[model samples]
Target chain A: MRDIHTSAITDAVKKLCMEANWNLEPDMLRAFDRALGRERSAAGKQVLQTLKDNAELARTKRIPYCQDTGMVVCFVELGQDVHVTGGGLYDAINAGVSEGYKEGYLRASIVRSPFDRVNTGDNTPAVIHVDVGPGAEMKIMVMAKGGGCENRSKYKMHTPADAAGAKDFIVECVKTAGPDACPPLVLGVGIGGTFEKSAILSKKALFREIGSPNPDPALDAMEKELLEQANRLGIGPQGYGGDTTAFAIHILTYPCHITSLPVAVTIECHAHRHKEATL
Target chain B: MSVTTANDGIKDLSTPLSDQDVASLKAGDRVRITGVIYTARDAAHGRLAPLIEKGEKLPIDVRGQIIYYTGPSPARPGDVIGAVGPTTASRMDRFTPALLRLGLKGTIGKGYRGDAVKAALREHQAIYFGAIGGAGAVLSRFVKKAEVVAYEDLGTEAIRRLEVENFPAIVLYDCHGGDLYQEGQKVYAREGA
Candidate 1:
């Protein structure tokens, strides 16, 4: 078995946290450029332009993209043939989050409890998900999820007969979210799993690059159709109104029990900040 | 749908806005606000609301003042404020009308304000402005000075008084009941339909 040092994971997580917070991924930047061209409203176009400029300034100046630096969510794919050494994997990850948020000058947005609400100070205890995969390599994907968009995410367990209702459900969610979740959003729709699984799947789908087609042909078509319908809502950039309400809609599906047709929609703002590293 | 740029030419507005100033502004007008504005988010508002109900003096005066719903990152060395941007305004809706009754003239935030908050805006001759969500770094450039005025233990949620210059915002709700978010969406939805 190949041994991977947990310290390396901590260091990598720290750097990834800083990098993801400061820079808008290239795919997101390109999406904004394309949206700017397609947007019809002058005000919407202006908002898009400012978003582009903000991304540039954040990268060059090394400033966190938004004041809500976001709660760190990490997904880890650990190879079955690899053994972690030096320390516990979860502790290392949380340590990295603390170090990164403090050193990078990113906001520490985490609170100790949902109700009692006290700042964790260093953005610790990352929401981590781990899955076992083949080979001897480890893959780490990190997303800085802002509260505005996160608060707007939705999940529903529709009756099996309601399978076709995903489109309406998602559209309704976006319509209800309106300008609040930050329009020109990237929507991640997860289908066919259990309630919680669907929610996780939806969030995982967000890591996919904007405009990339889903591997399953059927799901890919649904993504396209949903994107078109969502944009037709005219929520536009910052919800001011125009043709580009959603930049992309990504759908992921898995087989589920015959009785269940669960779907979850995770809305991500234009700042779709995520970074991945393989070791 | 007719697009009226009612307050378009009035780009820079200072705090302690006059009645005429608030009356003249309409939803969808783009403006760069200047001078002093107070910052308060969930925690600060929670504390301030109780005191307001008790008829006690608030840490900051409410008369003719604008409260920005924000919890900014700590400013780095050599910067006046860290990335400071508006938070979701809906979260503040519960405590808003009380402050409005106390003569709070304006608010800066993102997202839709609930019906009651909009009603309070109309009744009190106040306004709501939307700053570009997620443009915190760029917005910080406009904050010329910032100091934590109260609730120091609240960290980012502390009440801060900021001196700003050319800080941009779009009027989302006006004292006359013009709602930019609803109006803007209707204009496009109809065209698309």
Candidate 2:
């Protein structure tokens, strides 16, 4: 069995949080370059430039990219052969999140209780999802989600006949959201996964690179069709008029109960900051 | 590298901004802004209405000022604030009435406001400028100077006065209640719809 130190996990978590905030990952930058060229509107082009400028400023100044900093979400994959050396593995992960948010100068957006609505001061008790895999290696994925896009998320169960109804609902949601989530945006549509799973899949879909087609032929076609409908809503970049409201629409689907059709749309603004590492 | 100039007062924002000036401004517009603006969002607007009810001393004067609705993150070391970006504007719909009455000239943030806000904008001759929602990096470049003028205890959510030069933004919903999002969509849509 491979011996694992809890402190290692903690330190990695902390450092990862800080690093993610301070720097924009290379892949994200490449995607931005592609977006700059695809955008047709002057305002859309300008927003892309500022986003690039922001990335540069964050790197040179060693500051967090946005003031929201975002709530921490960590996805972990562990090797089944590994055994913990000291302390609880879960606590170690939380510790990493705490230190990273604290030292990194990121915002403390977590709350103690949803009902009370009190800020937890530390962006702690992160949402951690762990999976046990076959090897001796551990992989971690981190994403900082902000309110602008989070607040606009929508999910619904539909009957087969309701498929057409969904187009209008999704379009309306985009229009209502306007430029708030920062356009040109990327839309994540999760189909077939259960209520929460659909939402999770929708978010995970955002990690996919822009312009990458879905592996499933049918799902890819649906994604293209959705993109056509969404941009037609006229919610251009930052809600200012002109084309290029969203950069892409990525969809993930699973088999659902025959009677039900589940769909979840997670809107991601242009900033879309995320990072991952394998240990 | 951008030249720094902060806090020149009302003169800083007097760029003679018009609907046309901002109409074509897509998501990011970086212009050195000089002039006066107001600040009011959800909580402040809520308190202001009650004060207008009781006629007490309001914390801020909204006349001829721009109100930004964001509650930002803490300031990082050697920097002013962390990841500062625009917050949603619909939350303040209830208290917007008092703001128009107080002579507020403009509101800046992401997203559209309710019709009542549009009516208020029309009645008060005000404008709504749309800043990039998550482009805090781009937005912060224009804010050459920032200081917390009120509500220091609120942490990132506290009220502050900022002095900006050539701060970029787009005219989304203007004084005439024109929305750019609608216009842009029409251009990109193909013949089928």
Q: Top TM-score: which candidate number?
A: 1
For model 1 the TM-score comes to 0.97
Number of clashes recorded per candidate: 0, 28
lDDT to native, each model: 0.88, 0.70
Expressed as tens digits, the lDDT of each residue in B1-193 for candidate 1 is 1122335464567777877789878899888787899999999999999899899999999898899999898788998988888899999999999999999999999998899999999998998999999998899999999999999999999999999988899999999999888788776773322
Model 2, B28-56: lDDT tens per residue?
22334554333445545655678878877
Question: What digit string (tens of lDDT, one per residue) describes model 2 on residues A22-118?
Answer: 7877766776787677767676677777788888888887677776777787878899988877898889888888888887777887778877556
DockQ of each: 0.60, 0.49
Q: What lDDT does candidate 2 reach at residue A149? A: 80
- Which regions in candidate 2 have their CA more than 4 angstroms from the true location? A161-172, B1-12, B15-32, B35-49
Off by over 4 Å in 1: B1-10, B190-193
DockQ metric, candidate 1? 0.60
**TM-score of each model, in listed order:** 0.97, 0.87
- Name the lDDT value of residue B149 in candidate 1: 95
TM-score of chain B of each: 0.93, 0.77
Tens digit of lDDT per residue, candidate 1, span A1-279? 999898899999999999998999999999999988778898899999999989998899888889998989999999999899998999989988999999998898999999999998999879999999899999999999999999999988888888668678988788887888888798888888688888888989999988788888988887787778888887788988888888888888888999999999998998789999988
